[model samples]
Target: MGRRILVVDDEPDILELTRLSLVREGYEVETAATGEEALACLRRSRPDLVVLDLMLPDRPGTDVCRVIRTTPELSDVAVIMLTARGDEVDRIVGFELGADDYVTKPFSPRELGLRVKAILRRGVEEKTESEHLKQHGLELDLSRHRCLHRDEEIALTAKEFLLLAALMRRPGRVLTRERLLEEVWGEGIAVTLRTVDTHMKRLREKLGPAGDLIDTVRGVGYRFRE
Candidate 1:
């Protein structure tokens, strides 16, 4: 009765290990050994969460994630990408491709479970907030965690919203990248400051004409227009 999870990895041992760990915690675990297989499984089994490996025998994991995102049928599924190392570029790219979270290899099973649980919880909260944010015009509803700009609903990822809230809280005041991450992502995770930059760019583009709302501070970081 727990959330259904699809874990995509080529290594049999890794797949079994993940399956056992999640199964023990009562998750309905399904797995795929290749990118192609994962897509097929997705059609048959709708998983609440997908744990994907960046390396796949067929298409790369990033491509798989992108495909899932482009396919309207599968866009809503939450994804956690498994990386090979502290490859920062892949991490950012995965996020851009719509992976909700990421974990490095040799990762702790407990940590992955916690990440999965947190993502699922966030998804539910975001859905509720999105529904409530329809009233605000071109402004973010922080209480409900949603954004509406010029009466048009804006789809923001978790990190994007966090970044926007940080910039908006100090409208017209320039914020350094370090400070933005410190405020938005918190001082935790050791994430690169560039993560803020990446999210900001995406957020701006999504905001359209309101995109100008996020102003780069040239030598410093950025600021939200007042």
Candidate 2:
């Protein structure tokens, strides 16, 4: 079967539009109208990605996102948040809550489809690369999508793992925020430079002392110490 996607949105029109768009992209699409239904679908089906709306009739979508992130069985699932609010702060909030991407309302179904494709493509690319990357006691098992610091596992969101992988793959090279954005978020996704910073901060915290290995070059970008 093709990659599974669970789309949660209360708007009947949007829900169907998103499903149709992704289906056209060759994805297996599932739809849910509320947060609780979304959660139930999550447990029942465990789709590879979820297109979630920030506002839900039953509970805030952020709350559902938190559940997915905290639950061990479902934490690694990718999330893209949908919202009517287009403010940067709202976008940042979604990112902070572990969303892989954010789409504002009145969005084109095609654009949303592209965003979903990029996120899912990222996972496929990771599997095709070198399986293990180790630097300064920080290690990434690319095949497994696992990060380890000195043999201790560090749970990271999907984007966090990809960001770390990008840095480690080019140790000692100063990757501009723009470059990192391209490599991690990929093309066709609308994300700002601050999005990179937010993920980096969270990545560093998860890495603990090993986080220091990622050096920020003032005004330029970031580099992983050789």
Candidate 3:
């Protein structure tokens, strides 16, 4: 079967529209109209990606996003926030909460579809690269999407793994924020430079002592230590 997607939105029109658009893209689409229902659906059937609306009837989308991130079973699920709010703070909050992407309310279904495609495509690309990379006692099994710090497994979100992979693939080369954005998040997505900073911080923390491998280049960007 095609990749599955769960679209959560209180508006019936949006739920139907998003389902239709995604279905046309060959995705298996399911939807929920409330946060409670969405969580229930998630427990029953895990989707590859969730197109979540920020404003919901029963709960704020941020809460739901947080739940997904904190739930071990749901940590790998990609989320794209759909909201009418376009404020920078809202965007920052969404990203900080582990949203994979954010789309403003007045959005084109085609564009949203493309964004979903990009996110999913990136996930696939990550798995097909070089099988293994080792540096300073950190081991990354790119094909298996596993990371090890001195033989102890380190759990990483999809974004965190990808960001680390991008840096390691070009060790010693300073990757500007814009370059990392394109390499890790893909092109044409609505994400800010600070988003890179947020993921990098989390990535570093997860890497533990190996965190120092990723060096900050002051105002320019980050580079994996040579």
Candidate 4:
């Protein structure tokens, strides 16, 4: 089967439009009209990705995203938030809640499809790289897509896992925000540089004291401690 996608939106037009667009791109598409329905669908079966709207009738989309990130079985599912609100704060909050990407309302379905393709492609590419990275009490099993701290499992969203892997793979190398964006989110994705800062902040917080290993090089960018 093609990559499965669940598109959650209250608007019938928007929901069908998104489903049709993704289907045209060869994804098996499902639709949900409320946060409750979306969560129900999620619990029933896992999709490869979710196109979640920031606003929902029963609950906020962030709540659904929070559930996905906290649920071990769903944490790795890639999510692209759809929002009428273009505020950076909303985007940052979505990222903090573990969304992989966001598309502002009035978005082009083609661009959304591209974002989906880029994210899924990145995942497939990473899985092909079987190397494991261990350092500073953190271990990344690239093949298994797992992160561990001192042999204890550390839950991370897909972006967080990939972002840390990028830094850990090149310890001590100062990776500028632009470069990190390319490596993590891929080229031509419409996320801002602040998105990097937000994800890094969340990554560090999740790492606890080990977060210190990711050193911010002031304005230049960030590097993993050597």
Candidate 5:
């Protein structure tokens, strides 16, 4: 089967439009008009990715995302939040809840489709031959999508994992913000440089003491310590 996607939104027009666009892109798409229905569908069979809306009639999308993140069966499912509100706080909250990406309302379906493709691609891209990376007291299992610090498991969102993987793959090389954005986020997606910083901050915090491995290069960008 093709890549599966579940789009959750209360707006029928938005759901239909998104489904149509994604179907045209060859994704097998399913949609839910309420958070309840979304969860029901998720329980039946998990999709590869979920396009979740922040506002829902049955329950807040954040609630659904939280459930997905906490549920071991659904934790690895990639989520892209759809919101009418573009506030930084909301975005931060969404990310904190483990959203893989965010798209604001009045968005172009084409661009959103591109973002979906980019995110899905990033999930499967193999950056290294070895399945495990051990450096600076941090261990990343590429195949398992798991990270360990001081032998304790560190939970990371999909984007956080990708961002850390990118940096570790090129240790000692300074990766500019623009470069990191391109490598991790892909092209044609609308996202600010600050978004990279935000994820990096969270990524560092999750890495605990090993956080120092990712060094800030002042104005240029960040680099994994050599």
Candidate 6:
């Protein structure tokens, strides 16, 4: 009941629907029809989470997300990418731009609402108090679909994030490429080794100076610093 969410989209219909869902969940909601408006609104008041449409009227949704991720003022805000685009590359782009989660278009409102709530809850945790080696300097609130590093928040695409989380959980232990693919991309799904490499490159770049956090084991797989 205390949460506030900002929804940015060019579509009036979807905006209205998303607003209705969040409002029903007992949270304050703000809607923007353009990326410029969303940026302006966010500048005035920080929201608990952001539902960002991949397509926008002014700049590309990826650009908007980049701005949010790079800004110190809005660093902690959790962002969920909402767009009609479902391509793997698009998802990686969203993550590289610092998105906490990715949800394709025509997604269920009920499911979205649950995800929104979870993301919000995850954003507020204190990572130092957490038990696991847990990727220090980085705090991942899975409920909120957001990640924070060195007290500065970092956005990750859904898959990159999943991969990061999976590796982090096993800190110091090497996870084979096949195992990572299975855990992050889903078992029985046919994928390429290049796909894994590409996502890893993107993830490392966004991690900035901390890119070495994920280590390539060579002839084996990858390992996260314990």
- Candidate number achieving the greatest lDDT relative to the actual structure: 4
TM-score of each: 0.56, 0.56, 0.57, 0.56, 0.56, 0.54
What residue pairs clash in candidate 1, if any at all? 138-149, 138-150
lDDT measured at residue 33 in model 5 versus the true structure, 0 to 100: 98
Q: For candidate 1, which ten residues in a row score worst on lDDT? A: 129-138
Expressed as tens digits, the lDDT of each residue in 1-226 for candidate 3 is 2299999999899889989999998999999999999999988899888999988999999889999999999987888888786785455445578888888888889999999999888876765566688888888898788999989999999999999988888889899989988988899878998999999999989888899999999988999988
**Candidate 2: worst-modelled 10 consecutive residues by lDDT:** 87-96
lDDT of all predictions:
0.84, 0.88, 0.88, 0.89, 0.88, 0.83
Any idea what lDDT model 2 has? Answer: 0.88
Q: What are the clash counts of all predictions, listed in order?
A: 2, 0, 0, 0, 0, 5
Kindly report the root-mean-square deviation of model 3 from the true structure over all alpha carbons.
17.7
Q: Where is model 5 more than 4 Å wrong at Cα? A: 89-95, 126-130, 133-226
Residue range 1-226, candidate 1, lDDT tens digits: 2299999999999999999999998899999999999999987887888999999999999889888888888888888999878676555445578788888888999999999889998888777663232221467787767788876678898888888877777777999998887887777769887877788889889988888877888889898777
lDDT, residue 113, candidate 2: 83
Residues 37-154 of candidate 4 have per-residue lDDT tens digits of 9988987878888999988999999889999998999887888888776686455445578788888889999999999999888767766778989997899998898999999888
Total colliding residue pairs, candidate 1:
2
- What CA root-mean-square deviation does each model show from the true structure? 17.7, 17.7, 17.7, 17.9, 17.5, 18.6
Off by over 4 Å in 6: 89-95, 127-226
User: 184, model 5: CA deviation in Å?
Assistant: 35
lDDT per residue, candidate 2, 86-201, as tens digits? 77545444556877788888799888988888888887676566668998888899888888888999999999999988988989999998998898889767888899999999
- Superior by lDDT: candidate 1 or candidate 4: 4
